[model samples]
Target: MSKIQKIKGFSDLFSPESTVHTLMENLARQVFGTYGCQEVRVPILEKTELFARSIGEETDVVQKEMYTFADRKGRSLTMRPEATAGVLRAFIESGQCGAEGTTKLFACGPMFRYERPQKGRLRQFHQLDVEVLGTDAPQADAEVVLMLWTFLTKLGLKNLGLELNSLGCPECRPVFHQRLRDFLATIDHTQLCEDCKRRAQTNPLRVLDCKVPACKSLVENAPSIAESLCPGCDEHFAQVRDILDSAKLPYRLNDRLVRGLDYYQRTTFEVVSGEIGAQTAVAGGGRYDGLIKQLGGPDLPGIGFACGMERLALLYGQAQIPAPDFYLAVLDSRALNTALLLAQRMRERGFSGEVSFEARSIKAQMRQANKLGVKTCLILGQDEMEKGQIVVKDMATGVQKNIGQDDLEQALGFRKP
Candidate 1:
């Protein structure tokens, strides 16, 4: 029989990759929590209608990428391809929609999509999502972006630039939509990707977001929605920019950042890194002022962004294995349980390390300790067990000493938990 293999475009995360993932999540909690944003978790699977309603039906994510199917009862279900829709559903169902103050939430987890995977893009990828709901104020937009920027900087990511754009609102988008439609109509059929071709009819703005180089070129001269913003929409976007400017958060205006979602309106932004090849976006989001109402909640506003963890790990390089404080090596089968108990006691005292699962030769155990980069090694042998003493070796200095069992904590320097 052959060993089973992982599915294509999906991957197993272990070692340094898992370490980096952990670091990102820890940093997310630390930084997002500092901004008064509470952490929340949502189901990975949801009713397919949520996505179809949140992300437009014609968008690439819904039409091609989502992992959707009918359940045993025949009700259509889908694994979430993105975080926002599910987060919003949780927010609405929790009845926080009628709350007076703005609600801020952050989530971290895997999302599923059926698209072709590549560097930094996978079928099952993780995201650090941050969202702010119940406020349409431009400060909310600026705050969310600033919060995202702060978190990325805290993670030690460099060479990143923030791009800002406004997709206008329902009032002005129709006119820009028509103008964009007109320009897309003039492009020859050969120049556009199939996805962009469909977008040209369903949402011409998405055609501008096409990843195909040829497709992007064909729509390069398409009318910019920024130039067509309604007075209110224009004002909201301007204030967001002004706030960003006031905070010394350097940003560039990209008239073409109509993110590939239909829920966005007014302000949109992305933090891009040159370090990551062609797919520059490590994070992106915008204001969805009408989504709450559309989802049967109070007519409120929300804005958020998701950081792609895979791309971030690429920028940060490999993660280091944190060294254990000690390694307990057992040289007698009778001492196995005692070594485990001692290691447990060490842990209870706030020291972290590992213990041998079975008795082994001193040399073999030392080799294992060295491989794990443990700084100290405690030897458990028949003689030491009988004498009620433990052999403690300083791995760094290559020195050894026998200490009475009662003095082990004092000699090993255990700390209070």
Candidate 2:
């Protein structure tokens, strides 16, 4: 028989690392709630067409990265490569868009993609996603961006760089698309990467986001989206900027920062950290005004963002687990029941406690207690039980005291207020 191993690009989180993961999720829940966003759970798998339509069939996510397959019924299904499309699908199918108020939802879970995994990129990864539906106000865009910024900074990530851009809405984007196409026609097609070349024929805006050195150099002098924005889009972008500025948030205008999604329009932004090399974008999101309607929902606009949980764990470092309040050592086998009862009582009273189950020597039990880093230890043995008392030892100070069995609660200061 062969030993089983974890598949490539997938990993198991253990100990302190898992603890940090919980901390990250808990913090996100608390912070996202403060922004009036409620939790929404969506399935990991959905109809393959959901992504093909929302993420655009021409984009890299749908073209090459999605983990798509056929079900037993020969129906196409795909493990979601991102959260936004799945979220929108749920919103439309559940009729949340028909509700009166704007829907602010947040979700966190694993997203699967088939791309080659690298340092911060994984085939199976996690994201902290937030979305706001039924609003076209630029303030909604600014608020979502600010919340993402606040969430990252609160996680101890420092020196973040904020980049902002706007992809004109449908009315004006077509004109810019033609202008961009015209410019690409003048350049030698051989200089562009294969992916860039295909994107040029399908979605020209994506060419500006190409990471290839040659393709990047070619687009350096390409026309800017700012000049082609319709008056409505231009005003929306200005207002988003003004709001960000009013809040004293600093950001740079990056004309080349067209996010790798087809739904974004009007306002787009990314928060990056230099600590993570090329995958510096710790979080990114933008407005998707047509997604809700496109997905068979009411005509409503939406904005949202997603942060890579793996990259967050890498930069968050290891978090320290707090020490237990008490460690109960069974110095005698006869006292085992008493120690277990006392530990349970302590826990019920809101004090964390642990008990040793093995019939080890007193010295061995004490050594284990020290390793647990407990503040104090309750030593129970035949001798102490005979006196109707328990031995309480302060691990840090090495001080010992004898307390009546009934007085254990008082001695530990756990006697309810």
Candidate 3:
């Protein structure tokens, strides 16, 4: 028999790493709630057509990265590479669009993709997704961006930069597409990377997002999308900028920041950190006004963003294991029940405590308490039980004190409930 191992590109989060994940999710729940956003739980697996239609057939996610397969019934299914598409599907199927004019939702869960794994980039990763549906106003775009900025700052991420761009709308994108295609035609196709070459013919805008050094240089002098925007898109982009500026949110206007997704339109933004190499974007999203309607839903506009939890964890520095409020050590097997009851009382009083489950010597129990880094330990033994009292030891200072059983909660600095 062989020992089982975790699949490549998949990871097991343990100890302090799992603790950091919990802290991030808790903070997101609070911050997103403050902004009037409610939680939405979507499935991890969705129909293949959902992503194919929403994310576009030609995008890298659909062509290469997506974990797609055929089910037993010969129905094509895919594990979601992103959350927005499934969220919109749920909104439509649940009839939330008719009930609630606008929906503000936040979701946190694992998303799967089949890409080569690297630092901060995993095949199975998690995201904190936020979306505001049923609005076309640029203020919604600005508000979503602002909410992301506030969330990141609250997470103790510092020295972050916001990069903004506009990909124009259906009415104006054709003009820019033709101009970009003409420029690419002039350059020898052989000089470009294979992906960029394919993208130039299929979706010229994606070439701007290519990271290849050669493709990047070629795109540096490519026609700017800002210059080709029609009046509607231009005004929309300007208003988004004005709102961000009025709020004193500093951002750089990068005309080339065409996000990888095919759904983005009008306003696109990414929050970046220099601490992470190469993959600098910690969070990115934009206005996808037509996404809901495109996915067989009502004509509802939506804007949202998603931050890679792994990338955020990478920048979170060292993980700090949380200390327990108390550790209950039992010296004699006969006093186990008493120790458990006391520990439960402490927990109900809002103190986190752990009771010894195994019958161990006093010294061994003390060692376990120290290993857990608990601040205080309540020692329960036959002697203490007979006297109707307990021994309290402060792990930090090695101080010992005796307290009546009834006064245990007060001695631990907890008010009686």
Better of 1 and 2 by TM-score: 1
Clashes of each: 0, 0, 0
- 1-417 per-residue lDDT for model 2 (tens digits): 999999888878897988988898999999999999989999999999999999998889999999899999999999999999999998888877779978899999999988787877889999999999888998899999999988988998877889999998999999999999999999999989999989889999999988888999999999999999998999999999999999999999999998998998888888887887678887899999988888888889999999999888878888999988888888888888877887888778788879978557878878988999987888998898788899999888999999998888778755543
lDDT of 1 by residue, 1-417 (tens): 999999999889888889999988999999999989899999999999999999989888999899999999999999999999999999999988778998999999999999878888999999999989988999889999999999889888899999999988889999999998887778797777877777778777888888888987887788888779899998988899899999999999999888888899888999999887877999999999899888888888899999988888889888887888889999999999888999998888778889999998889999999998987899998899999999999998999999998777777765545
Clashing pairs in 2: none
lDDT of 3 by residue, 1-417 (tens): 999999999999997888889999999999999989999999999999999999989899999999999999999999999999999999899989886567899999999999889989999999999999988998889999999999999999888999999999989999999999999988878879988889999999999999889889877899999999999999999999999999999999999998988999989999998988888999999989888989888888899999999999999976787778889998888888988998888888888879998668889989989988888888988999999999999888989888899998878765644
Model 3 bad stretches (over 4 Å): none
TM-score of each: 0.97, 0.96, 0.96
Determine which window of 10 residues in candidate 3 has minimal summed lDDT. 408-417
lDDT on C-alpha atoms for all candidate structures: 0.89, 0.89, 0.91
> Highest TM-score: which candidate?
1
Question: lDDT winner among the candidates?
Answer: 3
Clashing pairs in 1: none
Question: Whose lDDT is higher: candidate 1's or candidate 3's?
Answer: 3
